[model samples]
Target chain A: MLADQQFLRIPGPSPIPPSVQLAMGKPMIGHRDQQAKSLIKQLSPKLKPIFGTEEDVIILTASGTAALEMAVVNTVAPGDEVLVLVTGAFGDRFVKICQAYGIKVHRLDTPWGEAINPQLVEAYIKQNPSLKGVFATYCETSTGVLNPVKELAAVVQQFSNALFIVDGVSCIGAVPVKMDAWGIDILVTGSQKAFMLPAGLAFVAASKRAWNRMESNSTPRFYLDLLRYRNSMQNDTTPFTPALSLLFGLEQVLRLFETEGMENVFTRHKLMMQMIREAFKAHHIELLTPEDAASPTVTAVKPTDFQVEALRQTLKKEFQLTIAGGQQQLKNQIFRIGHMGYCSPADVLQTISVIEVALVRIGKQLELGKGVEAAQRIYLS
Target chain B: MLADQQFLRIPGPSPIPPSVQLAMGKPMIGHRDQQAKSLIKQLSPKLKPIFGTEEDVIILTASGTAALEMAVVNTVAPGDEVLVLVTGAFGDRFVKICQAYGIKVHRLDTPWGEAINPQLVEAYIKQNPSLKGVFATYCETSTGVLNPVKELAAVVQQFSNALFIVDGVSCIGAVPVKMDAWGIDILVTGSQKAFMLPAGLAFVAASKRAWNRMESNSTPRFYLDLLRYRNSMQNDTTPFTPALSLLFGLEQVLRLFETEGMENVFTRHKLMMQMIREAFKAHHIELLTPEDAASPTVTAVKPTDFQVEALRQTLKKEFQLTIAGGQQQLKNQIFRIGHMGYCSPADVLQTISVIEVALVRIGKQLELGKGVEAAQRIYLS
Candidate 1:
């Protein structure tokens, strides 16, 4: 039987705070009511600092992926040439969404665990002068690798006509993404990941540059039509019905983050990432991505001569742990632990302790106490 | 000033039942965890009955409109000819989403308060043999008109190749939609409506016939990709991160409906619609739509020569009542009272009383005692 209760492990939709959950429990409001308008109005401005841009941040009643779709559909018209940086699943998704809309996508494919090379991207942009847009992920959730968005944005700025769309789903609220200063025209994020809420709504911030392109774009869009939202945003309302309960939950969490300060949030994420990385190393488990490029949200580790699948099952069955297996071809080859929103240092330490116990139970040759001791060192440090 | 603490008195995000609210408050679980998968698996079955289809239902983390877009993009490709029956705002949206994808849409425009004529739809299909699909709404939430889906489905069935897609967003669970029996290829609904949960997730059920078209159709879709969800649904999960809390809330609501039985649920909605209609007549307010075609979920009324907006505002301020305003050009000309999902005769009576009070407050010269009397007669009847 699967572990039936208390799923505190595993990243995202990661433990929603009690207060946020309480907010969701509030009575549902009419999506078109003036109250709903005020809520959306307040939320839009509140999210500006989160994106590090004064540009409009519209909340779509969809997932992070939908925000990415909104960015793709709104930016590129039919037959528009685009450059996509592919490192993991989400980047590949961006490529696919672009292709789906009949947009020509040129992918700068990188190794699964590696980050996109800024120089390579610049060269590609230079070569493909007709490229209408560039899509990249700030943090590749699939491999826990962070692309150098600042450098990539600089290259994109050189192509004044091309829109730079960044899927900051896993990166926003965890890392600093300066949409305005970085010249990122479209930056998208989801509430579930870094916002520390349940997945439902996606946050998108668009510069006027992107809006200019949208004015002339001929692609058919209704629900995620940024223009309708743009018009509605002028009056502090949305075109279609919004997710009010989720908006309330988002407000509570964003306020909590504001009180905590974004810099402190980023620093805390870094500390958590370091704690997990150091623990894996001491336990002789290899980190998949290089240290410099590792995502602060999740850490993927390769086991030392053990059946990762069996170990994962044993961890779930015995210790009630719920870590993630590698996606697609990497399945059973790597296990990932997410130390994202609402996860504290004690969470990191305890999760490591459970992994060490599971490892020893699975007869993983040596290093019985190594992982916990390593994690304890990070906790104290 | 925006009305603060005003309850959303509209049909949905329908009051977020305390049970569903408490369910939504449950801590967020890992998207990949067995706990989440269990929730999804449980939800997948529950959604089928609601969709009136035995076919697989793909759950997207999006609003009702987002699901509508998913259905359009998945079923119809660019340049595909589609017949859209526009009776209300939602039908117009269907046309817009279709046109966005470069699908040529022929609108069978009906008056806003009127339902689409089934015969007209059939004639349009016959005239345009090249038309690949017919898009219509089961319940036009805007005008409170329920279109002739069964009749339209009967007509569309004559053209085996033309897919019949129904936006069941506001009608599902409140009314009967027999997808298989009615030949509806694609039917979409949202959690916010009859499901009595927050607005975030939209559930779509695709017939095998729709799947055949989706298999060959090449309109760009990555986020709302039905195929990805179709393939993933085999494993009882979604391809992207879902709104897990909403899923929990949906599970609780579905269970409630099951315990109550579908027939009883439909009966409740019918009774509520009756109660409201009687009240409107007693108030001497003309209904915008015909009683025969009125939605069981909502009632649209042409308020007596009075400031309809002011009355709605007063209702919110005084009675803590919330109702929907007319959309598009109809705004301020008509007001809609929703009586769907978790609303009973008492809720209908309370809404009627508030409307009467607000009418008097705004000096709408009408007999004050008649409205509640009519509602009482209907409730007793």
Candidate 2:
């Protein structure tokens, strides 16, 4: 193992790019300075494109979970009914946040490692005509399943007036999300994921419908209050002291997105997803999420021939490459690989080759070069 | 003007030491990695001396405001009667956060430029006898007044069983805070102030008395939940993704505090505060706070002969130096000089000299070198 390098391959808190690192390390500046105001003004418009919305994107110095709480507390009041589509762990968080605030939740659970069916959502919406809000996760990080957010959004709008909110924390920057065009009322994401920065900042963009609900809704809140953020953005700054270093890193991350072009960035993620999935298939590994429901950001694999922990330990102990194991119930049953944010197709190839060697070392029957060759062929295509 | 250099003399977002800056710029690491756990384990104990507490100091990936919110929601439920001592703008924020969460606030407002009288607090505690919590600010950044928290704690402990929570945002590290021995139930601080880092992380240390209160409280909170943080610290990690870059900076900051022992560090801040106050006295400028009430971290000065805005502009334009003007009601009426964390005796002298020059340029009657000479005498003494 190399002494100086650690390959961070988690789904979120992904690898930070070099230029973004340099930006974060720059000397601190006054948050109220004209330069800070300029950074704030430039950031909102630049971020709108990634969110696929023309609405102002509110910047918060908080974790992605705070953004999820903001979504719950701002629009829906306590005792109000809402529907939560639970595909995985992140979606369940919405249920918890809502229930914590006394919002009655009508939860619909999809099988693990599978996407939510849009027809089921339509049926729920039809049954609960008075549901004030509908929550969904765009990319479920736990099971590596990408739900059809557009289809689900269409279903909500067609059947009911419930405001549609999507937690896009794991895939907003890597995928195409038309929040404005698709009638997604509110979309939330964090910097640690695809923004290629540390985990201190979260972004939220809201439709006018969401804002109207917030104004009329009298949920008691302070820090997670979105209207305070909206009022501060009018002056081109944050309501409280901002995370200046993260903002510095965000400026550079935005430049990276622009330089690559949003379309190209999306294409790269899709390509890496294809390469890794094809490689896993060649190794005869049991994939957790079916190919049709797989998320482009992360993929789950179940190794039946050898212990999953043994394979993971071998990879970490030998190559210093880290992959996440399944969370909660999936623990000891499946291992997950994250290939998003600052990740690349080259990283995918390198990871598959290392896994192939690791499998052989763990006494699993596997051809050493087969996985690498499969990924390479897909990369060339 | 030098295009590359700017002296940030503001109270917060302070000038980072070179070592802390370099530490923050280090490459990213996984939040769930063994190294990350090691970091979390190291940070809490090192922070105990700063808070003067034996309890675990919870690290949060948020601005200081979130810590304040956490203090409110965790211990006191809505409709619980609490006494908030409003010494300045920050104290008013406590009132707002309380009222927002439907907590019944019995606010006591002190004059803007003076500290709260302990006698008044003792009397109020005797009258109410049943307040569930008493909130106070250690350093009022808005007015540069240092509240006598030790005395306040004594009063709270003597008369009532109310939990005592302190907002030590601006002065916890520069001064002294004994959360445990002082009978303080909770103390909150932000990294941007005396921690010598960027504004992404906030720390909170709580007494067992406060935790007992939280165990029975039913206020709804998710993101700023203190119990989740306490549980996660047991596992040597944050419940959510942490601000890894800021943690890197904090490790370096702890080293700085240790290298210059805690007592010596406090003495340095005392010296800076004395030097600046004596300099202002030499210039015959008006000081807003009484000598006994002045904060070691920041001092507010009101200039009657010259516009505060003009002096601030002259300093910025001529020397690229930035100091804060008064906030809210005192805006354009006073200017503040901050001398804490990463600041030195040399910086105080340089700042005094620059202000002397700026005073003369702004057509105020001030002899050159008078302020600098006065500060020099204090340093030598």
Q: Can you give the DockQ of every candidate in the order shown?
A: 0.01, 0.01
Candidate 2 lDDT score at position A246: 96
Per-residue lDDT over A256-311 for candidate 2, one digit per residue giving the tens place of the 0 to 100 score: 88877889788888888898898889878889999889888999998787888998
Per-residue lDDT for B1-381 in model 1, tens only? 111123456857676665677777788889989888888887777778777788987888999989999989988888888888899889999998988888998889999999888888777788889888889999999999999899999999895468999999997988988899889999999888887878898889988999998899888889998999988877877899888888888888887788678887888788778878887786678999988899999998987588779988887765567888899979998988877787655455546655665676777775543565565556445
The TM-score each candidate achieves on chain A is 0.96, 0.99
TM-score for each candidate, following the candidate numbering: 0.51, 0.52
TM-score of chain B of 1: 0.96
Which model scores highest in TM-score?
Answer: 2
Could you give candidate 2's per-residue lDDT for residues B3-109 as a string of tens digits?
Answer: 22356778898888767877887889999999999999999999998999999999999999999999999999988999999988999999999999999999999
Query: Which sections of candidate 1 miss by over 4 Å?
Result: A1-4, B1-381
Off by over 4 Å in 2: B1-381
Model 2's CAPRI class is incorrect
